[model samples]
Target chain A: MSESAAPGIDTAFPLSPEMRAAIIAHARREAPRECCGIIAGRDGAPVRVYPTTNIAEGNRFYEIDPKELADLEFRELPNENAEIVAIYHSHPASPAYPSRTDVELAFWPEAVYLICSLEDPDKPYIRGFTIRDGQIAEVTLPA
Target chain B: MASESTVQVLIPTPLRRFTDGESRVEVSGATVGDALDALEARFPGIDERVRDDSGQIRRFVNLFVNGQNVRDRDGIATPLSPGDELGIIPAMAGGSAA
Candidate 1:
């Protein structure tokens, strides 16, 4: 499945324990307000997590710092021989699913969107999806 | 009063198809609207994506000039310099289900 990636969603995306922990930690740290970040890595697998500032007002919206995203997209990611494998955001009060806004603003059809849900707080749920155009497909993200 | 001077427009990933995969394009215009008109002339269907039926910028779409929001300036009438950068950012509202 890795050799032949489909046009949109990858079949499987396994997250590392450390990265998962870090993502959850970040979500907890920014509780009540949503946190957003990106995972950069080689090939199709992510190597590191990049936490970015959510410049949008309120908890229901997130606009990544354009300069930071641009630098990573144009310079840093290229220098590391990597691309933004996944973009992650936390759902502070909702389920681990893409909202209407997420579906609408999914610019990268190729990258996986990892949404961490802190609805339960104690039992945080992290799910991954591929959002292409206006359609969404859930992918298996076993950690 | 649009001139032949070229202003760079930063096209986001989703709209690359209209640009033939070019993330950035140079178009001539005196104001934001003129540049967009030039872009629409070059790329047939992009105007509809950027604007609405009333020719107003879609609420979810944000156009930035020189790293500043056009809404904060003069909307489509925002003046442009020869080397100004215009960026298109579709608003990404976050996780909480509403």
Candidate 2:
């Protein structure tokens, strides 16, 4: 009945310090609005942050840079060192929550979907989710 | 005014601190915006958490009512009745250099 009904992909990686920093930095840089990016990793450690532009403009939505995503995938594939483990974005003015469009467009159940909310810009809220067949389940971060 | 059949609103962990750790809350409104407004009124600073200076929904945030995304319905204009559950989820990102 829904697109998320499709099978999920794999996203069992942990957030490295570098990966966490990148996301926090992006959120800060895009203050008053939202910022988005991707994480590539393997063996459960995020290694890189591929920053993507949010083409949604003023709306509360996002569209990844196709060219950048493609390039990142291409570059990572050769080394066999990294794979897309997670996709991330910020909530400039609200709490971090998956929207309806997010569920409908979620094609990767295996990849962690991370969100950062600027509800308290000084201390943003971060979360992870796994969407499968339109069902969303929260994932707890490792302490 | 919201009808008696609208859904319940669930505040995520991050926002729960502001809401006294109450994960799920109940509110009534005919539209999503109305429900949010009601939430803001009940919980101060909540409006600021979800909207920008221009009063628009922030990017990277998603609102789901009854397991359905409000974006697909009508965004702030999405209709609401009693007995529904609303979820507020945030987007996450970041990584260290190798």
Lowest lDDT sum, 10 consecutive residues, model 1 chain B, at: B89-98
Q: Which parts of model 2 have CA positions greater than 4 angstroms off?
A: A1-13, B1-98
Off by over 4 Å in 1: A1-9, A56-58, A65-82, A104-107
For model 2, residues A1-143, the per-residue Cα lDDT tens digits are 12221132232336666676778789889766567787776555566778887655554666664334544543443366676677888777766777777776664455678887777867876788877677888766544
Model 2's CAPRI class is incorrect
Q: Distance from true position, residue A34, model 2, in Å?
A: 2.0
Q: lDDT by residue for model 1 over A6-119, one digit each (tens)?
A: 333376776787888898999899878888888887766779899998887788877676656765665577678776677889998899999988887776666788899999
Taking the tens digit of each residue's C-alpha lDDT, what string does model 1 give over B33-62? 999999999999998988998989987677
